[model samples]
Target: MDPFAPPPFGAPADLGEPDPRDRPARLAVGVVGAGRVGTALGEALDRAGHRVVAASAVSEQSRRRAAERLPDAALTSPQEVVAAADLVLLTVPDDALAELAGGLVATGADVAGKLVAHTSGRYGTAVLNPLTRAGGLPLALHPVMTFTGRPDDTGRLSGVSFGVTAPDPLRPVAEALVLEMGGEPVWIAEDRRALYHAALAGGANHLVTLVVEAMDLLRAAGVGEPGRMLGPLLGASLDNALRLGLDGLTGPVARGDAGTVADHVAELARVSPEGLRAYVALARLTADRALAAGLLKPEDAERLLEVLAD
Candidate 1:
């Protein structure tokens, strides 16, 4: 499975002309590091009617997988991939991005006049400096969604918001790229990239941690299938929260039930002492939200905070 090889999948659909906002030139797209994110994004662009001219992967396995999924796309070296495409997506890991960009520059992969982008949330256009200095317009366009290794991963990309950051001149192009992928584009300042990424991580990554902790507690409480027991409740609560916003909040804290809060704290301390800290932290945060929502009076919030703090 050479990561650099094009997938044996059927020919990709024709990506229409360059995004209408883009210069009338049809930009050749090159995907570097054909891993899950790269492959998924490539497929998405293909579906959007963009030309995915070439793709490269660091491993032979990835190359083969890429070949199977993007049979019409060329399998080549990272440098060659960039050279062949007018737009280059460096979807490699965060730590490896700088090295890969530097490698491409060292190999004289003239990135000048190219639209260079990466899917890293942790880095902004700075990581693409090597390419930018060589005349490329560097941009950071990260999709706020998860990707697995499946070829159909592109489906998850639809309707997702992409955090886009690029220079003034490149902003329109960056936004157009997001639209081309059927995603909403939100422009973020380069300096605020960390803050933007942190917010996403807090909601997505930490939510997963909170759910896992809840499941562990449930299992310890004699639940044979924690997920089955928690899934419906979690899903309904999430849906309600999204639909009704803060007004959808309910539960002991929202009702200012001090006794219930104390009981939860005591139970967490007894079952999972480490988890108690998280419970306390989240409760305190929720108390503030409840107060802001006018669901909890100031006094009630104070009382709840007292109980949560302990």
Candidate 2:
């Protein structure tokens, strides 16, 4: 069946998930926000053979993404998308998700019995209670990959984990969708959803900030190609850290080289006070963890702690 052509509306409801072989024709998907994430996912679902019927884009970038990634999907309002979809993906920002769902409810839209999912990492199904209370089936499906608002992003979804939170009866539905998108589904308890999201953000987002800060400092220190200079070191550090946990730590802190660490602190203090603060704080924490991991001796760490505190 052509996805642009809607499935006949009178099909009987099947609360259970559709079989993998029948999913493409059995469900009609809609996107409530045609931003980077929304378009990429719509493309993924479309690639998995699901029919993307419509999507809503409020900005030029979103509109362009929708045009590129979801060309056949009608550029329609959220209400229209909700009306036509058997499964509606609310992919707006975290701050706007609740309000958007509330708007859909307030408008008395026909969301009843439809599978409604949101791509908010910080929130679980609770943020979608407004929809569920109105008879919509709620599921939280936060993709654990970043989006670049590019057409090629759909390919990157393969093999990444998707943090899923749904009711027991709907677990299969959530997992099946993630699998359809070429992702692993990790069930996240609703209460621990925030922590799950925080771990991802700290690892991904904060890591990016840290790398950029290092690059800035390197450029200031007369390095012409900061990225080239740090790429191998950062990559090896990340690989070792993941493979060996805290035991993978290397550097002055891990070796408890107080003199070298104090030299770093003094140089950073002279050149960049902000960088010095960050260096000291991180080195202190690294030393603490190192000692606990038996990588640093008490006598060796004592002098390092004094330098870090100074």
Candidate 3:
């Protein structure tokens, strides 16, 4: 068994990378959860020439998704998947990863010598300690993209960032694998995994919540098409914020319009108290960032802070 040789049988076809890195030899991969992320990643790895031997899909929806996304791979149990594969992709929930790994190890699965990876954003290689202790090579591959379990979801994985956390010895192997998956590897330290994941959740997940809340408020205020109203404004805002960061901060908050801010707070308080609290919290944070960015003067922010505090 040559280390650099591709999987002899039961592997998918070969592929290329975005950044023109070398596509490493394919491994016998097994996905231990056929959820959205798991199925998509398994497909992507298959496209990268890896042999997806089997996948674990419990729910009906998951089984269907696995059949769709991982058609080449057989459906089976987690322990079987772990045992059969050279690389095991454990794409379970964050909370379930440890227990799953422990259970597999306890059941005398051959975790040792396998590249045991999990697609958990909140954790790094640390969460795969059970596998590691069992002599498995731990890899944390977190794609910083949302999934819909649709047909085209796998195509979107190209040219994206993957928060990769692997041991120093396995760094090249992990990164090469990421490149083969058509993603750039953003090395995340074991210690900073939580913060790294937090930042992503704060930006992506919280942005979704904020946008939905805004739309709800718009609907509450008798706006017929909340999406239409917010579409362009949010598009530009997001573009600017991505390009300019705090310099992109705008609205009454950035301008330090205390009375206007007060009016917003009062209106939200009257109409939607939930929106009011969020508005206040975000506005204060925006104002603070604006001041720090030198976009807002001390004297200008004083009244705004006073109104926000009130």
Highest-scoring model, lDDT: 2
Per-residue lDDT tens digits for candidate 3, residues 9-63, read: 3222434444211345557789998999998888888777676889998899999
Candidate 1 root-mean-square deviation in Å: 6.6
Name the regions of candidate 3 deviating beyond 4 angstroms. 1-25
Model 3 Cα displacement at 185 (Å)?
0.2
Question: For model 1, how does the per-residue alpha-carbon lDDT over 187-226 read when each residue is reduced to its tens digit?
Answer: 8888988999899889889989989999999889999999
Query: Model 2 over residues 114-218: C-alpha lDDT tens digits?
Result: 889999999999988778888888889999999887667899999989999998878877888898888999999999999999999988997898898899989
lDDT for predicted candidate 3 compared with the true structure? 0.85
The model with the greatest TM-score is: 3
Candidate 3 to native Cα RMSD, angstroms: 4.1
Report the poorest 10 consecutive residues by lDDT, candidate 3: 3-12
Worst 10 residues of 2 by lDDT: 2-11
lDDT value, candidate 1, whole model: 0.82
The better-scoring model by TM-score among 2 and 3 is 3
Better of 1 and 3 by TM-score: 3
Q: At residue 39, what lDDT does model 3 achieve? A: 87
